[model samples]
Target: MSFWDDRYSRDEYVFGEAPNAFLAAQSHLLPKSGKALAIADGEGRNGVWLAEQGLDVLSLDASPVGLEKAKKLAAKRRVKLSTKLLDISDYDWPAERFDVVAGIFFQFAGPDLRDTIFAGMIETLKPGGLLILQGYGPRQLEYKTGGPGILENLYTEALLAEKFSALEIFHLGDRDGEVAEGSAHVGKSHLVDLVGRKAG
Candidate 1:
C-alpha cells in the first residue's frame, strides 16, 4: 500500500477529522452557495464543512481509505459531498472552474508536481474566485510536529507568490499557531497561510 493508503488504514486520522485551522478561520469568506473543490482532501472534513455551508462540494483524494472515511464523515455531518478516488497527478482538473478552491495541507513531492498542481489550481478557479491554502513552512522542521519531513515539500511565501502570480494576494504570511490535527499535528506550529483571489 502507498504511504497515504497506509496512513489512512489506521483507525485515527493523521490530520484529525476537523478542518484545518486556517480553513475554519476563513469560513466568513466562503460563498454561501456555489461550487467548491477541495483538492487532496484527505478525509473530507473541509469539503463536508463547505457542503454544510450550502456549497456543492467535490472532494478529491488519492486514497480509497481516506475517501471512505470522508464519506462516513460527510454522512455524520448530514451533508452531501462527492468523492473521487484518483491520483491528483493523473486526474483531469475541471475545465469550467469553481467559485472556491481549497488546498489545505496538500503538499507535493517536488517542484515539477508542485508547479503543475498550482497551475491546475489557478485554472480550476472561476474568474474572481477565491483560493484558500495553508501548509507547513520551512520553520516547521525545527518543531518536527507534523507535516511531511521533506524540506522540499514545505511551502514558503516567496514560492506562493511565484505560484499564484495571476491572483490578487489578499493575505500571505508565515505565523505560529496552535494546530490540533489528531495526534500527528499538535501544539504550536509554524505554518504559511495564503488567501488569494483569481483575476476576473
Candidate 2:
C-alpha cells in the first residue's frame, strides 16, 4: 500500500468530513447545473458537497481505501457521486469538459506532472467554465503544519496565474486561514486560493 493508502486505512478521515475552506468560500460561484470534477478527492468531502449542491460530480483518487470511504460518505450524505480509482497522472482527463472543476489541497510531484495536470484541468473545462483550486503556498513550509514536505509541491499565485494564463482570474490571493481537516491538517494554514473562468 502507498503512504496515502496507509494513512487512509485508519478509521477516521484524515481531512475531516467537512468541505474545504476555499471550496466553501467559493460555493456561490458554482452553477446549479452541469458536470463537476474533483481531483484527488481523498474522502469525498468536497465532491459530496458539490453533489449536494446539485451538480453531477465525479470524484477521483489514487487510494482505494480513501475511495471506499468516499463512497460511504456519499451514501451518508444521501448524494450520488461517481468515484474513480485512478492515478491522477495516468488517467485520461476527459476531453469533453465540465462546467466546473475543483482541486482542493491536491498536490503533485513536480513541474512535468504539474504542467500536465494543470493543462488537463483546463482541457476538461468547457469554454466559460470555472476552476476552483487551493493549495499550500511556499510559506506553508515555514509553518510546517501540514501538506507535502517537498517545497516543489507547494504553489504560488504567480505560478498559477502563469499556468492558467488562458483563463481570467476572478480571484487569487495568498493568506492564512483556520483549517481543520481531521488530524492531518489543522490550525492556521498558509495557502494560495484561485478562482478563474475560462475565456470564451
Best candidate (score: TM-score): 2
Q: TM-scores of the models, in the given order?
A: 0.95, 0.97
What lDDT would candidate 2 get against the real structure? 0.89
Q: Write the per-residue lDDT of candidate 1 for residues 33-54, one digit (tens) a residue.
A: 8999999998788998889889
| Each model's lDDT | 0.87, 0.89
lDDT per residue as tens, model 2, 83-157: 999989997988757899999988755778988989999999988899999999887877778988788888898
Q: Give the RMSD in angstroms, all C-alphas superposed, for model 2.
A: 1.0
